[model samples]
Target chain A: EAGVTQFPSHSVIEKGQTVTLRCDPISGHDNLYWYRRVMGKEIKFLLHFVKESKQDESGMPNNRFLAERTGGTYSTLKVQPAELEDSGVYFCASSREYDLGLSIGAGNTIYFGEGSWLTVV
Target chain B: DQQVKQNSPSLSVQEGRISILNCDYTNSMFDYFLWYKKYPAEGPTFLISISSIKDKNEDGRFTVFLNKSAKHLSLHIVPSQPGDSAVYFCAAGDYTDKLIFGTGTRLQVFP
Candidate 1:
């Protein structure tokens, strides 16, 4: 099976500019998520989408950041008037809905795409 | 405050030896723990996982041990190979919730 794929593996933009990152998850996966890792820090959750509807967006940092999952297929994360602190690696992950009785190991396992590296100057 | 933490920033191990990475979590609600391996410029790959009900889970060459009472977990790789060298991340989550990750530990294996 093909793994999750992300667009524009690396990007550099001036501060206050806008940038959008795209992610195509593995086929048939309904649970998609967005996470970001600042340099030298742990990867932190941004938001999650269960097929088009957002399940949780509590992790979103601020109003400038927006994420959308259109048609329950792929996802996009956009940062408006990006700040220097917005520079980080953004990762997109997907997993099948969990069937608790089945196998927790693989059922809840999430696969990630090669992250999009963003640098704001 | 960081819920999950890998105290060690890096570890070095000789090939054919055992490599053990440790992690600690402050959240007691976390019931599912996972370990992921990541190479530079790539995303994390799931290595192994253990649920709170069990103390130990072993794969072919990898093992995960969870100590619920202490809120600690560890990953052990036997007979380490050079290819196994990478950054290892520890993650924890509640049932079906988003995972919280630790600052990764970089493991280097030399022959």
Candidate 2:
């Protein structure tokens, strides 16, 4: 089975510009998520999508960031008027949603993509 | 504040020896923990995981130990190989299924 795949492995854009990152999750996976790692910081969750509906988006940084998954397929994260601080490695992950009470080990496992490196200058 | 933390920034181990990585979390609600290994230009891959109900879970050469009381967890790799050198991230999960990760520890294994 192919794992999650991200497009434009590396993106460099000027500050105040708009950039969009894309992610194609594994086939049949209902749970998709977005996360990012800034310099000297741990990877942090951005948002999650379950079949086109957002499950959680509390981690979003600000209003300039937007994520969408239409038809429960691929996902896109758009950053408008990007700032320098937004530069980081953005990762997309997917998992087969199972009962949370069943087995915590494998049931809730999430597979990650290679990540897209975005640099704002 | 960071909920999960891997205090050590890096660790060096000789091949054929054991490599132990440590992690501590501040949140008591975190019931599940996982370890991920990442290589340059690649994404993180799941190494092993352990639930709060159990103290230890072993998989071949990898093992994860969770101490609920201390809010600490660890990953142990036996007979470490050169290929095992990479950045290892410790993550904690709650009922929401969101994995909160640590800053990661870079492990280098020498032959």
Candidate 3:
């Protein structure tokens, strides 16, 4: 089975421009997550999706960012009016719904895709 | 406020030695902790994890130890190999599924 997959592995955009990054999670996986790592910063969660519904988006940096998961299949994160500070690697991850504090052993682990490196110049 | 922190930005170890990476978290509510390994041009991959209830968990050459009292966790790789070199991230979260990640520590395993 294919792990989570992301497109446009690398993107370059000017400030104030818009860029959309897409992620295709593993087949039958209901959980999808978006994360970003700024320069010299840790990877921060942006949002999460359970199927097509937005579960939690508290980590979204600002109003300029939007994430959507349509039909509970794939997801897209869009950043508009991108700024220099927005340049970083955007990662997408997926997993089955596992119980909290339970074993992350076989059949209950999260997988990540090759992140999309975005550069805002 | 950064909930999780990996103080060391990098670590180097020779093959056949032990590589230990430490992480500290400030949030006592975080009930789950995870470690991720990222290779160049790849997203961070699931490594090992331990629950707040457990003090230690091991898999193959990797072992994760959690100290609830100190809110600290460490990942140890025994007999480190060149393939073990990568950026390791520590993440903590609760049932909410919102994970707070620490700045990664790059591990260089020399042959």
Candidate 4:
């Protein structure tokens, strides 16, 4: 009954460092997604995971960003050698089914974490 | 290429009035449209959605209208209340189930 949970509500690191954000989606959710919004831009899709498999990663900003879903229960997004432009809020969402509507979890409500406010200085 | 766009940056309305937020998309592949409401610190929450099969969907005081021909959609809140104030995002779904979102419109319903 818990909503989507993300770790390290806030992160601040010098450029060229590394950071990993974790998301624990609702138990049993088959669909997991990652999205983010840069300082002054609209939120953009990063990728999606379905049962430990990468479904789509077309929106990933660059090779520096990597995502993994071990066992499809939870997910992790890693940014290596982070750059100043990577500063933003990253969110994770999950859905129970691909149905037109309904069947989506409240977690699917896309309940955002307090948001991992990442600031790459 | 921004597929979904929320033209209005912000809208204001008095309590008990009607508030309408608009969104447009340039993509023809979009098959489903949704509206989400978000507070400053939290993540976006699904308010309502309409599929390509339907033109209008309503729940209580919130109604979503979709015009696939024009690639536009709107969220209308009747008798707006102060609690309804928040940033509203319009999203479109493509071939994949991924939700592409607009920049969002901020709504302020004054009491």
Candidate 5:
């Protein structure tokens, strides 16, 4: 089975610009999630999608960020007016609806991305 | 609130020795625990998991022990190998539908 796939693998945008990261979860999987790690901080949850419907978005950092899971197949996270603080690895994960074990995608690993490596100059 | 905690930032151990990594949680509602391993530039890979109903779960050379009373859990790797060097993260869930992750502890198995 094809694992989750992310787009642009890496992105570099200037401060004040906008960037959207995409994730295509495993087929037939109903759960999708977004997480990020800023600098030395732990990876933090941003939001979750259970088939197009956002189950919980309490972890979203602020108003500058927005996420959508249209049709429940693919998910997107948009960071606006990007700041230096947003310079970190963004990860996407997905799992089966009833199964708690996340069948992660290869690109969604939380390690490092070559990283969007944004220079908010 | 940081529900899960990994006190050690990094650990160094000799190959063939045992490496014990610890995790503590403050959430009493969490009934499921998991460990994930990550190599540099890679996403985390699921190691093993144990539900609250079981005190322990073992897979190959890795063992996960959960002590519900203390809200503490540990991952023990016996006969540690150099390939086992990576960052380890402990996570918790409650059928709350989402997993909460710890900061992670880096494990370095010295040759």
Candidate 6:
């Protein structure tokens, strides 16, 4: 089976421009997640999706960033009016829903895509 | 505040030697810990994971030790090879699905 795949491996845009990064998860995976890593910082969670519904978006940085998973398949993260701070690597991951009784590490092993590198100049 | 931290930004090791990477976390609620490796221009790949229920877990040449009391964890690579060179990240998670990651530590193994 193919691992998670992302599009436009690298993107360069001017400040205030909008950029949309796409991710296609492994087949039959229902849980999708987005994370970002700024230079010299840790990878931070952005949001999660279970099928077509947004499960948790508490990690979203601001209102300018938007994420959507349509038809419960692929996901897209769009940043509008992008700032210098928004230039970073955006990673997309997916996993099968965990069984309530199983250990989190074992049941919810997430697979990541080759992140999309966004540079807002 | 950063919940997870990898103090050493980089490490160098000779091939056939042991390479140890350390991590510290502040959140006591984190029960699941994981280690990931990333090459240049690539996303992190899960290496190994350990649950709070155990103090150590090993696979092949890699071993992960978790010290719950100290809120510390370490990854050990035995007989380290040049291919082991990469950036290693430590991550923690509670009951929630989201993972809190640390700033990565770059490891370089030379022959």
Pick by DockQ: which candidate is best?
Answer: 3
Best by TM-score: 2
Cα lDDT of model 1 by residue, A1-121, tens digit: 9999999899999999999999999999998989999976899999989999998999999999999998999999999989999999999998887522135555457889999999999
Judge the docking of candidate 1 as incorrect, acceptable, medium or high: medium
- For model 4, residues A4-84, the per-residue Cα lDDT tens digits are 888888899999999999998877778888999898579888998878999899999899999999977989999998999
Q: DockQ numbers for every candidate?
A: 0.59, 0.67, 0.71, 0.49, 0.31, 0.57
Q: lDDT (CA) for every model shown?
A: 0.90, 0.91, 0.90, 0.85, 0.79, 0.91
Please give, for residues B1-111, the per-residue lDDT of candidate 6 as tens digits.
899999999999999999999999999988788899999989999898888888998989999999999999999999899999999999888666788999999999998
Badly placed stretches (over 4 Å) of model 6 are: A99-101, A104-107
- Candidate 6: TM-score of chain A is 0.93
lDDT value for candidate 2?
Answer: 0.91
Q: What is the lDDT of residue A110 in candidate 5?
A: 24
**Which residue ranges in model 5 land beyond 4 Å of their true spot?**
A98-119
Over the stretch A64-93, how does candidate 3's per-residue lDDT look in tens digits? 999999899999999998999999999999
Worst 10 residues of 5 chain A by lDDT: A103-112
lDDT of 1 by residue, B1-111 (tens): 999999999999999999999999999888788899999989999888887778999999999999988999999999899999999999888755688999999999999
Displacement of residue A104 (Cα, Å) in model 2 is 2.8
Regions of model 2 farther than 4 Å from truth? A98-101, A106-108
**Predicted candidate 3 versus true structure: per-residue lDDT over B1-111, tens digit per residue:** 888999999999999999999999998988888899989878989898887888999999999999999889999999899999999999988877788899989999998
Tens digits of per-residue lDDT for model 5, A32-105: 88877777678777888889998889899899999998887888888898988888787787776533523221
Pairs of colliding residues, candidate 4: none
Interface RMSD for candidates 1 onward, in order: 2.4, 1.8, 1.7, 3.3, 5.5, 2.5
Error of 2 at A58 (Å): 0.4
C-alpha RMSD by candidate, in order: 1.5, 1.3, 1.4, 2.3, 3.8, 1.6
Native A-B interface contacts kept, per candidate: 0.53, 0.64, 0.78, 0.53, 0.22, 0.56
Tens digits of lDDT, candidate 4, B42-107: 888878877777888888999989888888889999989999999999988855788889999999
Ranked by TM-score, the better of candidates 3 and 5 is 3
